[model samples]
Target: MTAPRLLVLQPSQSDPLAKLGEWLEAEGVELHLVPLKEEPAPASLDGYQGVICLGGEMGALDDLEHPWLADARRLLSSAVSQSLPTLAICLGAQLLAVATGGQVRRGPQGPEVGVLLVAKRDAAGMDPLFADLPFTPDVLQFHSDEVHVLPPSAEHLAASPKYPNQAFRVGSSAYGLQFHIETTPEIVLNWAAKDPESAACARPTDFDLDFLAEAHRDFEEVWQPFVARFAKLVRGELSPAGCLGTQLPLV
Candidate 1:
């Protein structure tokens, strides 16, 4: 059987796939990364079985400053409409929201940072990607903006105290995560150093090497298998029958 090929759109150089890539590759999924800043964004999803849009430092609405954002949004809209297996993280999540008739804005509750937990909504219990997750899963939050309103077609999945739209799904296979599951300690530290204001919003202990290290361990325990399952869904090893009776082809 051919390994499932996923197109990973990296909106920022700092936010590479990191541990998420390791986990997905371990599950036998092949990743092809496209750094939108350096290369042209693909106009179509012709050859890939899955798409993953990573976080970025820019706001989702800043299309004028970052022209690639417009292209990225178009691709996300296409992916969701086609029922392609897709995952959007952080800024990517906000982009997904806006691209699909949702809303995103500078978070009114301020930047949500640090290692935190998000509670799953009732609908998450039936979601293909979120169903198996713990009631409250560990995730890393570092964004200044939030997806305030989900798209018309989205099903709410998870929420934190400050952000109501932590995770959501559109169509049958596309998911948008408001938190970071692809970060490492080094990546967090780099984000902290670059954006001190957002870093200051976090608890003082959040930056401690020991504390961050332990948090990452907890994150791995919960999210590694979640990513593996996503890979399986992309490869057609699993079915999403519970999520509106949709089933992917077994490749």
Candidate 2:
């Protein structure tokens, strides 16, 4: 059988969707990454089994700065409308919420950084996407804005101490995660090197190479299992056994 085709909507070249790509490649999944900045209008979602939106520095409301955001939102809307299995991370999650009638706004204080814990609010009786995860799972995070509310029809999945609206599901197949589950040590280091501001915001006092290395190590351990879980969900698997077993039916 042919591997599932995943459509990756990327915002920029510098911040490539690293961890998601890594997970997909390891799972033997086929991916077609369409840089929205370059190609604003996506062709169709018919051939693809899932869509993965990567994190970006741009806000969901900043269409003037990054025009592609509008198009990306439209694509996400279409995907959700079709009930395609979709996953959004970080900025991508904010975009999904915005596109689905939810609101996205800046936090009252400032951006959230470093490794944090996300608790499953009411995911116990829900679908198997979050089946085996601990009630509260520690995950890496770096974002300024948050999803204030979920779409009327959406299901709240997880929350963090810092942000209550950490995750939600638009439909049975679509999910949005506020934390950066798709980040790897290499990717985080690359991002920190290119964007000094994010790095500074992350570690205000001691923003240096050594600090970044240490931070990367701390985050990697927290990020790995979440990435593995997300990969299982993408493959329509429920638990570790399901992930280890042959891939499940697409639906």
Candidate 3:
């Protein structure tokens, strides 16, 4: 049999999708990293077993600024129509929300950054995408906007203190998480140092390279198995043990 194809929609120079590509490559899956910013076409998503949408600096509402946004939304809508397995992170999640008739707007108060706890919503137990995660997981977050409302057919999965719609599942297989489960220490530091202005605005004074490195180490162990479980779900191997409860730190 052929390898399971995973299509990644990448739109930023940051290349955060590389982290997920590395993980999926190790699992012997066929990976395709497509930069939608350059070539935005709905046909690009064809023949992929699963789709992952990576975060970018762009806002979902700014379709005029980024013409690719419209194409990406069309692709996501088609993916939903087919019930294809999909995982969206950060800005990608916002895009998914907007494409599926949800609202993506600036937070009522401010941005949510650093590591924060996300409480699983009522339908989380039945969500195959969230398999192996705790009802309350301390996940990495960095976003100024969030999904305020979900589509009529979507099921809420997880929420953070700052953002109630942190995670949602649409049409069973398509998942969107506002936090960054694909982040590593290197990736976080690279973006932080490169974007000094945004960093200054979102990061607290105590949020230094050292802090990010330490958090990366602590979260990596928890995130690895989580990704593994998600990959398994994409491959259609959903078992009972795969239904992950809330993951708290091991003492």
Candidate 4:
């Protein structure tokens, strides 16, 4: 059988897939990356079993600055409409929200940065992507925008005190995460160095190389398996029965 193929749309130079790409590839999924700043996004999901849109510094509505964002939003909307396995992180999540009849804007509470925890909502207990995660999962938060209102069809999956729409599912297989599960220690350090103002929202220890590395270790322990399950969903080896309050044997 052919390996499941995933189309990964990278919106900026700063937010490369890093560990998330490694984990997905390790799970035997073929990834095709399109750096949106440098390349045009494809018109549709064509040929890809799954799609992922990575975070970026740009706001979700910044089409004037990054024209490709329009195409990215269209692709995300397409993925959700088709119930294709989809994952959107941070800015990508904001885009997903807007593409699907939700809202995104500057975070009123302030920027949320650092390694943080988001509690899974009761609805997450039956979600194919979120059901098995710890009630409070460790994630890297580095965004100034928030998805305050979910799409009308979305199922709320997780929340933090500051951002209520931390994680959600737009369809049976399309998921959006308001935090990062894809960074490496070095990538986070670079982000901190580039945006000191946003970085200030985090604890001082968050930038420490050792602390960041250790946090990544903990992050992988929880999210690597999560990515594997996503890959399974893409490959048709896993079912979305959990969405209906049932479990199907893995193929």
Candidate 5:
């Protein structure tokens, strides 16, 4: 069978899907990255089976400064409306929220920037993608902005102490993750180097490469299966092993 192709929107040159790409490709999902910051948005979602928008430095509300954000919002809105399997990370999630009539602004609790645990909401047990996650899964939090309100159509999934919008599902197939599961050690190190204050506050002491590596290992262990399941959803295989043994058919 031909591999399923997914359109991956990369909004920033610096932040790309690092290890998450490996899991998807390993499962035979073809990734076609679109640099929205550098190029125009595609006319439609015609050829792709799914969409993935990665994290970036830009805010979702920065349409004036970054005009492509408007285009990204349109594409994401289309995906959610059409029920195309979609996953939006960080700023991408913020864009999806803003596109869907949800609200996004500076997180009042401040920037979440370390390995943290987010509790799965009871509603997550009913979600196809989130059902199998651990009760308190370790997730990387590194965003300054947060979603304040969700579209009425959105299903709340997970939450951290400070950020309640850690994970959510809009429609049946589209998802938004507030934290970073696709980051690699080098990526985290780069972010830490660039913004020393946030990173320092996130950790007990100074940044440690070895500890970051360990954290990445835990991240892979916890979230790679999540990505694998997402890839299966993109491929139209709702019943396969991933984080969840078999996805329940959506009603």
Candidate 6:
């Protein structure tokens, strides 16, 4: 049998999937990194079992200035049409949104910076990937724009009270997360301090790198298994768990 392979599209020099990549590696999933900003999008998704696009500092619609975005969106659109397992993180999700007949714009609520709790929607119970997560999983949010209109085919999965489109799954294998599931403490600290807009959105004092580290550990305990499940889905070793109801977290 062929080993499970996923395409990782890196859109920025700054943001990368630090922890998520590590967890996926431990699952025996092979990763193929594409520096999409500097190079061209792959001509085809032929041999890859799955695809993942990480966040960037830019908006999803800035295709002209960042012409590569057009290709990135096209790649995501093609992946969904092919029904390949895909995980679009942060800006990637936004790109996926616009690619799949959805809309994204400057969040009316402003940038949702910092770690926040996102509750699983009732529909999430039936989702293969999200069903096992906590009622309110801790997700890292550092985006300025939000997914405004999800494609008609998309099913809402997890959501934050403030941001209703925190997560969604389209087709059988395509997933979109408005929050960042993979980020290091240094990344968040840099975002909080260096980004003039993100820094202005909230109280910088609350950034608290030490506290963010603790929060990230909370994220790992919940999301690492989640990433493992995705790898299994890609390998076809496990079937979608489907709806199992709200699982009680181990004490």
Give the alpha-carbon lDDT of every model: 0.91, 0.74, 0.76, 0.91, 0.85, 0.86
Tens digit of per-residue lDDT, candidate 3, span 87-122: 888988999999999998888867677767799887
Error of 2 at 117 (Å): 1.3
List, residue by residue over 43-148, the lDDT tens digit for candidate 2: 5787887888888888989998898898878878888888677888888898899999999999765777765577887653455666556776667677888998
Error of 6 at 60 (Å): 0.8
lDDT of 4 by residue, 1-251 (tens): 78888999999989998998999989999999999989888877889998999999999999998889999999999998788999999998999999999999899989999999999999988777788999999999999999988998688999999989999988788889999999999999999999999999999999999999899999999999999899989988889634443456999
Give the Å shift of residue 168 in candidate 5.
0.2
Candidate 4, residue 13: the lDDT equals: 89
Determine the C-alpha RMSD for candidate 2 after optimal superposition of all C-alphas.
6.2
Q: Per-residue CA lDDT of candidate 6, range 5-121, in tens?
A: 899999997888799899999999899999887778899998899999999989999877898998889989999888888999999999998999999989888788877889999
* RMSD, one per candidate, in order: 4.2, 6.2, 6.0, 3.7, 4.4, 5.2
> Mind giving the per-residue lDDT tens digits that candidate 1 earns over 8-36?
99999999999999999999989999999
In the range 1-251, model 5's lDDT, one tens digit per residue, is 98998999999977887888888999999988889877888989999889999988889989888999988999999998788899999998999898898999898877888888999998888676778888898877788999999866687889988989888888778889999899887887788888777776697542577887887888788788888889878888784212323458999
Q: What pairs collide in candidate 4? A: none
Query: What's the lDDT for residue 11 in model 6?
Result: 94
TM-scores, in order shown?
Answer: 0.95, 0.81, 0.87, 0.95, 0.92, 0.92
Model 3: ten consecutive residues of lowest lDDT:
238-247
Clashes per model (N, Cα, C within 3 A): 0, 0, 5, 0, 0, 1
Model 6 root mean square deviation, Cα atoms = 5.2
**Cα distance off (Å), candidate 1, residue 22:** 0.5
Candidate 3 Cα misplacement greater than 4 A, ranges: 42-44, 194-206, 239-251
Q: Return the TM-score for candidate 6, rounded to 2 decimals.
A: 0.92
Pairs of residues clashing in candidate 1: none
Question: Ten consecutive residues with minimal summed lDDT in candidate 5?
Answer: 238-247
